[model samples]
Target: MSLVVSSINLKIYFMKTFLAITALVSFQLAAGQKTIELKDFNSLSVGSDTKITMVKSSQNKLVINSSDDDDLSIVNEGGFLKLNGGEDLEITLYYKDGLESISADADAEVWGKDEIKAKELSITASADAKIELVLNVKKLNTTISSDAMVTLTGKAENHNAVVSSDADFKGEDLLTENTNILLSSDGTAAISVKGIVDANVSNDALLKVYGNPKKVNEITSTDGHIKIVR
Candidate 1:
């Protein structure tokens, strides 16, 4: 009887230990599967049949499709975009027939090492869109082609900042600090610099500066003229 009782107690202890280990492993897996969501900083993952519209209060990173039916707009705020931060953010913005609008409040920065093909990209702000900060990076090689106006209220810097349509760029200070600014278009684009203007332009565009001793480093154009008024 003593031997049988001792064997039964050992089996019970083994079973209890096995159950505890299993529970711990299950809990760990569950914790690893959890996701994080914030109020001001949000991330939206779109499905094949849905469109995403975002209005950010602070800074955000967005991933969208260049060939989808969704439309994006940045009205009063600004944000940033990492196309391939970890994985590819493929939210396609279809032509006028797909997603209606994806707009932000302030400046919007887009970082994509590939090509960015769009019908139209519009940014309207009380300030300027800081595109030069992300342009000097060799990891980001992007091409922007739009039919609508590409407007900037601040300054821009990059290896290539091309606008194929009419551009309205107004800024108080244009800081190309250590980078270059390139503006080009088949149509006529006008740029007005309130303070210092440091950029290089193609011949087809025009630039007008209004300030005290505007520092325009280099102005190159195949057919455009730069008029400076102090």
Candidate 2:
């Protein structure tokens, strides 16, 4: 009786182990890649950047090709195209549709092509997320709430930026008049720009402007530093 009982216990253990393995395989198969598309949207909002890029296409279609299809989502809400991606992957983008505006939020890393053209652009970054965009636009606005980073290149009519925590901003060729550029840093922010700059800075932040200031404000930095180079 003892031998029989031992044999039965051993068999039960093997059966349970086999069942667990089978369940794991089924789950892996179910989590395969998925594909999705949208026909019409005026703007874009992405939660995070998983190695995404925009390319000019011949057709008027917005395509998102993901490395892991199951980890990407695209939605159209209120005439806006919203995108979200998984933690450590990338999604490629192809678009010719006339998108008017674009925004990145919720701790996302967004990278654009070298010559992305738009009417308006905005970025609200926090939680260590970063955005590197090279765009030709009319207006650009950026807000950094936490320890995030943003870098912008290309030409623009107006550039407005605010950094409140340990955030940073780097602007290249961000051409605008003295009256149209506003850059403010409330904390230990690091800001760099290569255009005519007029700014008000505070705290232990650093602002570097590589152009002239025609109408200067009382640019105050309580415990900060502001540097300008022609």
Candidate 3:
């Protein structure tokens, strides 16, 4: 009888300790976050060496973690949220409605934490920038140029990619229904297509195809290579 009573007391003690730790963690997380007041924005323009996590929220909001005290220049002009003037920054961007476009140049890193649902989304990364995102979009347009790289991991009904000047589109996990690609000037694309692929490769460009598409309409010469992934 005494042994069973001791066991019951121990279980109750552990449960109380667990609850206290959980509450402390929740409080710390809330303390480290603060909201930014920027509204009525439909697009994003990032131009800093920062990392951002985008969240889909019921209210259109922007947040940045207060642990890092990097100076940031944020503005909302003409339906676009532009972020700049920081070296080491961490931010959280929230939007209720669909985002139209995102452009990153020279130095920026941004990603979506949730599956971005949109009608049409355009991404432009150039001049040694890097962007990674997931999309549940109808029409997705991408232009990777001038040694930039864009990595995608999601689904798009129609995806059009134009890679040029040693740029790369790393989309092996981004399954597309129909993919149209224009690879030029030693650019590279690693994509997954389920329905059909239309490719125009030239001048030492390379297209790596995955997902075993139903049809591949290729217009290329010996100067370019279209390799199938098994």
Q: Cα lDDT of all candidates, in order? A: 0.36, 0.62, 0.86
Ranking by TM-score: 3, 2, 1
- Candidate 3 lDDT (Cα, whole model)? 0.86
RMSD score of candidate 1 (Å): 15.6
Highest-scoring model, lDDT: 3
Per-residue lDDT of candidate 2, residues 1-230 (tens digit): 99999999999999999999999987775564334455666676667544456656644334333236566667877777777774565454556646666566666676766576777766667766777777777777777756777777667666677776777777644555432333444443333344445566777676666546554453765666666656
Which should have the higher lDDT, number 1 or number 2? 2
Runs in model 2 deviating more than 4 A are 1-35, 58-68, 179-196
lDDT tens digits, residues 1-230, model 3? 99999999999999999999999999998888778777777788887675677888887676776755457778887888888765665688887776899888776777885888899999998887788887889999999998889999989999999999999999999989999999999999999999999999998999999999999999996498899897
* Selected candidate, larger TM-score, 2 vs 3: 3
lDDT of each residue in 132-215, candidate 1, tens digit only: 111112211122333333333333332233444344343324323232345566333344433344656674766554444336
Cα-lDDT of candidate 1: 0.36
Residue 209 error, candidate 3, Å: 0.8
